[model samples]
Target: MSTKTVLITGTSSGIGLATAVAAAQSGWQVIATMRDTAKAGALLAAAEAAGVTVDVRTLDVTDPASVEACLAGLDRLDALVNNAGAGHLGTLERESVEDVRTVMEVNFFGVLHVTKAAMPLLRASKGRVLTVTSVGGVIGQPFNEAYCAAKFAVEGFMESLAPVAATAGVSVSVVEPGAVASEFVSNVGLADNALEQAGPYAPALSAYLDRTRGAFAHAQTPQDVAAQMVELLAAERPAFRVLTSDAARAFAGAKLKDLDGSAVQTLTGTWVA
Candidate 1:
């Protein structure tokens, strides 16, 4: 049998990079992609250190042309890991609609584009689609309105697509992770004047930022989360929804059992108070 190929997006850093390296080490022909191949330094170094190799490609997930260009070059795709996403930190009134749209483009629409394009290859190979969503997708958080909304859209899409895709010989699953220690946190794409112009929501924003810092202080490592992803790839029967950590499971569980939505409401309400 030919070596199975797995294509991953946003492989320049964070979970994407870690997963790319780990998957390669596990014998998958990893197609590690990023918007800028110039940023491939760290990924290359990590792969070298792991004594593994990954095919680096440029893929801007927000662009369908790029998605097509990337996938068109691949002959066989055993799996697709939709890890390419951008984070935004702002409330609706505080930010432009365009800002939220950009968030959706990267986090939600990007997933759709890649998944839609990869369905043919995945279906042919009877492969799986694993998306790296956030715990925010399951339980909304303060000051995370835009980011959470995008992730929510993705989770809903994947959940709905799971059974449908299964009929096509393709499997769809989402992995929700809690706070992770990585450049993803620092690169939330929040504007510089955001805090200075926070004005009325300043205190709440401050509180949320502080709380976020605390959570990420003890955040899960990218490597740990990557291991779970590799495990999912190797699983003969992977679940539709998987939480990557005890913290994520516990946090997401709040909303899972909340009938009136009061549980998550009361819980997250305290973050800003």
Candidate 2:
């Protein structure tokens, strides 16, 4: 049988890089893409060490032209992994509306652009679309208003698209990971004096940071999450939603089961309190 082809975005580092390597090692023809090709060194080095091959490409998901150009070169696509996203840490009151829009552009609209472009190829192959969302997508967190909103949007988009996509022989799933040990945290743009600039929200921001630090200190590795992701991609009938860790399951499960929304409100409220 021929090897399946999978295209993954945001492969310069973190989960995208790991998933690219893992998917390739799992016998898939991997197309690993990032906004900047200059940062491909890490992914290249890791792939070499793993004895896996990944086709590195420039695909700025936020740019529709870039998405089109990248997919235009591919003849067949069995899977599309929407892993490209940026993290922002701020409350709406402290941050300008433009900042939130920037986050949405990368995390929300970017997914739509790529998915829409890949739908034709995916439909032809009867393939799947797997998006890497977050536990925040399910449970809102303090000081993560924009980031959480974007993730929540992705979760809803995939959820609503899953049934619709299935009718076209396309599978859709969202992978929710919690506090994975990856560069994703460092990229969140937390200035050195972020708390200092929090003004009246300083104490609350400090508390949220403390809780966040604790959560990440024991975070799961990207490789661990990637292994699970590849398995789902390889499954004959994969689930619509897959949580990458026990912590993620517990964290997202609360919000999933909460009908009144009070439990989630109380729990996430404690993060900032």
Candidate 3:
């Protein structure tokens, strides 16, 4: 059996790294792209120790030139995982215009740039396109106005792209995960005075922020999310979206209906309960 080729972005840590290993272990050729090759040292070492070859390249998703350059080297591709994303935590008013723009650049526009470039390869191979979205994508969070906005854009974009891809023999799917045990939230963008300068909804937003941070503290591991990604890769007929855990499933159900039952409980239950 021939190994399928996969191009994944943001493989330095978290879901991206875990998914890279999982796909490679499942007999898929993996190309792991990160903003800094040095940051991917662990991934390279692990792939080497496992005797699975992975092509690690530097790719700044925000840069269209960089995205195009990276895609040019790949002779063929079976899957393109738009897993590169950043979180922005702050009330919309507290976050400056530039900070919001930066979040959109990395989280929304970056995904579009890479997906646009990978479309041709995917169409040619009749492959799949997956995005590591968040529960935030479905339901907006309190302090994460900017982050939620960006993910909402991803969800909307993918929903529209799925039908188009279907006609072309290409599949598009999204993985909506609640809180996952990764450095993604800690390392994402934040305003210098986010805490001091709350938006119009300071009191409510702060409480919401507390709940979100706590949920992330006890979130599921990256491996748990990666397992679902592997299943999507193997499915002959995949759905448009897959929630990573029970929390995710519940969140998706509530979010699609705009339910405001209990964000904290829904976000934390998948891992804790």
Best by TM-score: 2
- Count residue pairs with overlapping backbones in model 2: 0
Q: What TM value does model 1 have?
A: 0.98
Q: Which residue pairs collide in model 1, if any?
A: none
How many backbone clashes are present in model 1? 0
Per-residue error for 187 in candidate 1, Å, reads: 0.6
Which regions in candidate 1 have their CA more than 4 angstroms from the true location?
none
Residue 239 accuracy (lDDT) in model 3? 88
lDDT values, one for every candidate:
0.92, 0.95, 0.85
Structural similarity to truth (TM-score) of each candidate = 0.98, 0.99, 0.90
Cα lDDT tens digits for candidate 1, 1-273: 889999999999999999999999999999999999999999999999999999999999999999999999988899999999877788877788998888889899999999999999999999999999999898888888889999999999999999999998888899999989889987997677777888899888888888888999999999999999999999999999989899999999889999899888899988898
Candidate ordering by TM-score (highest first): 2, 1, 3
Candidate 1 displacement at residue 151 in angstroms: 0.7
Which model, 1 or 2, shows the larger TM-score? Answer: 2
Off by over 4 Å in 2: none
Give lDDT for model 3: 0.85
lDDT of 3 by residue, 180-211 (tens): 98889778655566555665656665666667
Whichever of 1 and 2 has more lDDT, that candidate is 2
